[model samples]
Target: MRTRPAGDEEGAGSSTPPAPPVSLLRSGRALLEHIGPYRWRIVLGGLLGLAGAAAAVGQPLAARALIQDLGRHDAVAGALTLLSGLVLLGAVLKALSQYVLAHAAESVVLNARSRLTTRLIRLKVRELERTEPGDLLSRVTSDTTLLRQVTTQSVVSAVTGVLTLIGVVVMMATLDPVLLWTTLAVVVLVGAVISGVLPRISRATAHAQAAVGAMGALLERTLGAIRTVKASGAEERETARVRRAAEDAWHRGVQAAKWQAVMGTAAGLSVQLSFLSVLGVGGARVASGAIEVSTLVAFLLFLFYLMEPVSQLIQAATQFHIGAAAVARLREVELLETDDAPPRPTRTRRRSPAGRPATVVFDKVVFRYRPELPDVHRGVDFEAPGGMTALVGPSGTGKSTVFALLERFYEPTSGRVLVDGRDILTLPLPELRASIGYIEQDAPALSGTLRDNLLLAAPEATEEDVHDVLVRTRLDAFVHALPAGLDTPVGHRGTRLSGGERQRVAIARALLRKPRLLLLDEATSQLDATNELALRDVVVEVARETTVLVIAHRLSTVAMADRIVVMDSGRVRATGTHEELLARDALYRKLAATQLLLPTPEGFTKAEASQG
Candidate 1:
């Protein structure tokens, strides 16, 4: 599917570095702009890195001077004082820069983390289905975190190494142009070796991270159905599956490490080679009495300064690859447009306006799960006016499919969904959904306080409003029985509430919306005999004011409906009042005889658990 860029209001915080032209690894340098806001501070901390390198390099120069000026009283005090100050400055700057680097990298990582989180929650259902949950979680966690490490350590190292290397080259050129040329040639060779090894490191790092995401996905799916896993006794089998994925990650990490180690060793050895060349050439010049011993020592001390930064540079190069791999993984999600197309704040119905209450009309709608699967709905047409309408069909015959289309969870492949005569597709889903309340088959309530669940559709509702819903849905008794009415915790999926009670609570939530349309799919699963009658009474009363479309499994829902639309194989077989359908349709009679819900006992119907 095609997607537009995230609009200005929503699009922020996707900074990743561009490729570096001279990197040993093929991974490009991260762009300064894309280094994110946090990496900027890391760069600042790197500036102080020069001060630290100066002190270490200065020590050798000071040693050379002290020897050359031995017994020269004038040189002693000045050299010692300069050395002392350099040491002090380096120590202070080193501590400050390290703190700044760590803190700045953390802040940037946190922002990326939050952005990924918001995107995940807001992404369309279709997107979520396409991507692995485990991989997404890994991006939010492992991958983003690895990028943080690069910002703090790798980024700082690379900057400092470049500065120190420049300082060394300048000092060497001043000392002797010939020696400088020789050292630079060696630097080129070392760089070539590092370059050759880079692609392997990046590919390994990326693959390793992906393996970790795979492991996380496997665990999530298996553990999510732990009960089923145990009942089926497949624990050992699942464990082995995860172990294999983890092993793949381990192998990839080791391969990356091997390449990094080679680059590190090459950097360290290059320093020694340059140092050796300088010594041999300088010794011959000194033997001829053309160069002073003191000068050679000072330049050699400068060379040591190159060693630390060069090694750091090599390590940073490795980390650069890792961060790039991570960026590629994250870009897959970040680049997608998350904000759904703007739906109208208000609906535009397709049906022409009338004085009558709203009507939900599907005009010759066609739908298919896939191109290969024949249309589940083939130019099927039906209308549910404002009042109770029961949708009846045998299993696998599009009874539930009607609810899916009405809720706009899936649009009909062809034709239009018109509510109050306006095409629903034109309406903003959130606003459209807010106007049409849906109560699902299981009466699934989120894990939160009872009051929170009741206000799922409308949080700003008052206590009086909640109480009124309670009385109407026959939940007053449950409220009175609870230790804390409306405040009791409903465990995940309302496990704390019995099946019937859960159903009533869901109904209460729908009523709170004062919706123009209420679509219920198995909304009365938990209701016993008398409670079913009370719930049916509530639905019928609400239908008087608004449209109510129900997929009825029980006679109470059928009896309560102003009309019944019988469906079979995705087409409407007949439509009329209950008795009218019973007279005309064979399926309606069999359904009523077998599935009608009898009313509950009067006193027992009121025996509900109190809210707490």
Candidate 2:
């Protein structure tokens, strides 16, 4: 086992500094870009909303005609019919516009989520390792939801509200300039208060969103290791930690709600104050005979109707502030580094052939997980020439780091890693990875059917290929015992299977890929004696077809390797056959003695040594 250095698990307790706050202008531009695809639909919705406003405006004029008709004792049926038509038309247009905008909103959210997920999958390993999985998950799910309203409905609402407000003001001015001026005074005062409140809403919403992400991270952390928590009797402790996170989220959410409530109240107050001032001044003007009773009634009707545009404008601004926070969080994810290399063209199953065993070389390699951490590989030099090579060492000897470097999961600090005599950095990532299969220590299995886990690496593999690999890994009997055989659900992380079964399944999956190089880290650790012996034989057989690089502590497995490399303190100390190393290397001799693979001084015999 390789010792994990400090900062290796930084994401668990600490994270990179929070990204700088995104500018309002940049966030606004991002929102607009999200809306770009649905611009035509949004335009149609806005046009319909404007038409609805036009109909609403005509209702007041119709009411004024009706009032004049009533005062003159003239027939009023035509005036009543016109007012009813305007009301019905306005309602129908508003409904149609709302439906169009709602549909567009859902589409926008889908696209945003798809793009974010795509970017996340391609992000560099370093970025992923240093970020909480749950936090990234929240951005894909919750953050993208905010784009729905801001991208379509809020944008159209803002535009229609401004246009309608202008139209209402002009008509009000025509009715009575004195009353219009009086109404403007109240609106202007309220508008200034609302402007101040909007920024605070943005800031509050950003904090609230961050707290929600933290809560999600805590929940994910607890659930991911529920078995360990239960076994250790720490259920209550973990629950309390998650509960505290949830409480923090709740507090931040309330803060945002308070600011939003203030904005809402200010918007309503602006309309109410304008109505009172207009009524008082319009009444005085009517008394002076400057305007007719009908004109005063129509102007008052417009003042009441003015609330629609005012509320729309305020609502648009509020939604934008809320969405800007989500945009900033989303932008932070976008800024994380991603693999820039284009994937190599995939070969068709029929056209592709089996890969030749690859030669691997680590030339003066040096590596550290982070610049602040101590070096894991200190100018280590080694070579494996297409055969079974076993790396045996004490803990913290940089054994696992070699596989990581080979997979290009992390770059070497100041040296070269070559596969088939070519620098790995110069190869396309997909192409390089496709030729290598790595079975990690834990041997994790995804949540799916047995067949799904088996074909994960080789999706193009045939049913015959699956069965052949299963037999090689001695898993055919286990699959036959399963209720659904290959179709059985594996459960989360293959909890349904035993530890040894998961390891064999992982090996079978990797073998199906027909990789040129197979790297195994403690592949036999979970197995019983019977299964371990079986797997050892399978590995030896596979080594004849491809390069097999294994890290093992068990002398039983190491003894079978064609060559054994003794490693210590991040450097290769010796390379030779097991018998040759036992005769020459001090570390190899002690290690074999510990496993009882070699005879001890006090009790040793040829028969006992041969059996061992």
Candidate 3:
């Protein structure tokens, strides 16, 4: 089996992986890629905003002319008209820009959700085993929502804000160079303080998002097993656990909010301080006859106007930091591996054409779930040829692992598994899986109508074929009794159905596929004796035309197998008919006798027999 190096074994108890380094440049690039398709819309919005800023910029100049005309007792009608027009024009342009940006932002979110959802569904099974489903769901919903604001509005706002700030600075310089220098000094000092605060906002937001994901995962876990929790009387404990996660999220969110508030305060303070410094200096200059009254008024107006761009810049920065944290999470999901399998074929059929059943062979196969874990299968070797072959072993002896390997839910660490004289690894995944029908140990049913679950594997199966399989699995009567028949809804995980009913549904679904190889992992474990016997006859009938491999513990099921493979500690201990193995294999005999499949020997006590 595969093994991990000794150096990598340290700190195996850590509950979470180390956080990745946060890179603003990398995050920005990823955001740009997501925004690529909507670039033109964002550009149009930015242009409109620039136009609005231009109109606002001209208003102060018009007001200065109007004031000069009034002082000289000249006609001010023309100047007043110009000022009014600029105000209305600026308002209209800004409104149009905001609408366009909002639309583009929503589109960005939709595209992101679509791409992330596709990646999530196609992720390798091994990755899903290690990741929490609830956390993945949060990434798809909450995380992608962050991209809507940051991708378009924030990007365009930053560009327009910077250009507007520069234009306003130039206008202020024209009024008085000394006043402009005073304003610049104050802005520079506050800008430095805000720079230190942005990184903290990013870090805090990252922590808050992670806490939210953890909370979601915890909530999903509790709700998924609410019945079990209620049975165990652990409602209080689970509630406390989820509440702690929520509190952690709240604390981290508060930290992010604290830093954002600091940045906003600094941006506002810089503009206010610049205003005070310019007003005092310009009033003294006017007193010294260094500048006109109209000049001073216009300069003050420009200083006030500086606040708009300053606020925009700060808002853009804050949104970028928050969105970057989300981008990082989304990127981590994109980096996960996916199965390299062909797309599933669209055709459907009731059964494979009549032919010799497919044979299976496990040639010294070795396997494990992970590198750090011990091998679950140690050189397991077995063969099943065109008939019903049952695998019997004590619990945890790698019985279920064999079925998982056959389905390629996992890959063997070593050795080869062959189907019909060809290595399974050489076959396309879709083709390999399409040829086999498997019933899991739990026989899970999805949340949907009974018809939906029955048609999941064979969506195009005809009604006649469905009715035939349902009768064979002894589910026709039960399904008919339901108020809606096949249209009846099964609650989440088939909670609406009894355990026996779910198992029979699973069996019927598999039978509808008409697979060349059928794998039953405790297929009838939940069935009543009468139903079990009936399904056993169905399996015997199906095995005549196709291969059937089963992992069973009940003695009646094993006694009917054409061949039996007895396993012990991941190795095949014996393989033969049930009677031959019972006479030779100690483990098989013990298992058989435990179920009272054999008569009691002369010296065996009742207690020993019960404990066997």
Candidate 4:
């Protein structure tokens, strides 16, 4: 079994996977390009942010004028009136600007969401099986949310902050060049410190994002088997598992917080140093008659204004870390080569394919779950034409595994699986899968109306086709009892339907496909006699027109199969009729007597008595 991450400071140890870092700028550029459809909104939002920043700076300018004209009472009243108007105007513009920026950011988030979802669905089944469902969900939900934050606040603040920083710097130069140069020296030192810490902060943030993904995987695993967990009384163990993953996440978060605090405080201290340097130098220059008092006061106030931008700059930089972290997760999925699943290309819709019924042949085929291990289907050879065939085996005999290989979920490690003389590996997934209708034992029911579940197998199926299967499978009674009939909600995984009803639904779905080959795995495993009889009728109806390869369990189902192929330990052990195998194969006879044989209509009373 593949084990997920353990929540040990395990990472706190000497050897762990280095945290994913914000190490790729080219990837960042690619992200922007992919998200570029929302550029108009970003542009409009940026304009508003500039207006808001300018309005904010207007407040201090008005204050300076108010103070300068205080000695003249008439001038002071006029200055006070101007100040009130500027204040109200700035407030309104600031409010409107923030609104515009926020709304635009939301549009960016929406576009990103659509693109990610599209990418996810297009991924190959091989990858989906290899990847954890919860980790993928984290990318879709949590990482995308972080990306939204970056576009909204960080983009606007970065624009405004850079402008404000420059505006404040120019104002100081006019007051006294000597003081301005000293402040620049201090700013340079602070910038160096911030630069040194930024990579570490970004690295930690990326690890924090990955840790969230790890936690999602653990939660999904536990929740997926909640019934089994409860039955086994393993709730506390599962909880501890999740808690450990969460704690690992907490540690990564603490790493980011530590760096942020150190940088933020340093920014504040740097601003204070710049202010005191200006005040002392400007006052001495005024005393020496080299600078005017009013000008010095105005310059120091502008120096105070610079602090806002410096703080915004720091925040913008931190946002970069978060954005980089999110994009890295997104890219991990995006960069993976999609499985050979494209919707049946619209350009070619063949009225009649060259092959009528598929002739499947496996030529010395071999497969394994791991490349380093021995082959599961070791040099297997098989042939099945356009008719009914059965795969029968004991547990772990790789009967179900053969069906998986035929479906192309796993490729042969060597040799070939073929359809109509063409190697199956040569066909695109959709093209090959289109010709085969597969009914799994689980009989999965998607959350939707009954009609939706049925049509999923054949989206273009007609009403008459649906009605035929419903009646044939004895689902007509279930439909008539439900008020909404076909439109009635099935609930998640079709919990509202009984196991037999779910199996019938799967049959109805497969029936609609009009496939060249129908792959049925003991579709009636969960049903009683009455339901089993109805499904047998459905299988007989389907086998008439298509090749039916059934994985048989009960002897009743085995009796219906045209031929039986028995497998053991990944190799075919016997191929014969039920009577022939019962005489010669002791293993087959044992399996039939115990696990495979089902009581006939008359023999049921006797079989039930023998067990008692």
Q: Write the per-residue lDDT of candidate 3 for residues 82-156, one digit (tens) a residue.
A: 999999999999999999998999999999999999888888777776777778998999889999879654798
Which tens-of-lDDT digit does each residue in 20-52 have in candidate 1? 223323224332323656656776788777778
- Assess each prediction's global lDDT (C-alpha) against the native: 0.73, 0.85, 0.86, 0.75
| TM-score of decoy 2 | 0.94
lDDT of 1 at 278: 82
Report backbone clashes per prediction: 26, 0, 0, 0
After superposing candidate 2, which stretches have Cα over 4 Å from the reference? 1-5, 8-20, 340-347, 350-354, 595-612
Compared with the true structure, model 1 gives a TM-score of: 0.82
TM-score, each model? 0.82, 0.94, 0.92, 0.86
Q: Write the per-residue lDDT of candidate 2 for residues 507-581, one digit (tens) a residue.
A: 998888888899999988999999899888888888988899999888888988989888888888899998798
Which structure is stronger by lDDT: 1 or 4? 4
lDDT of 1 at 148: 70
How much is the lDDT of residue 86 in candidate 3? 99
> Largest lDDT belongs to which candidate?
3
Report the lDDT tens digits of candidate 4 across residue range 24-82. Answer: 58546855764487777677767666665666566666677777777444467766777
Error of 2 at 371 (Å): 1.0
Model 3: clashing residue pairs?
none
Model 1, which residues run further than 4 Å from truth?
1-43, 50-67, 71-75, 153-160, 272-290, 337-358, 471-489, 492-498, 593-612
Whose TM-score is greatest here?
A: 2
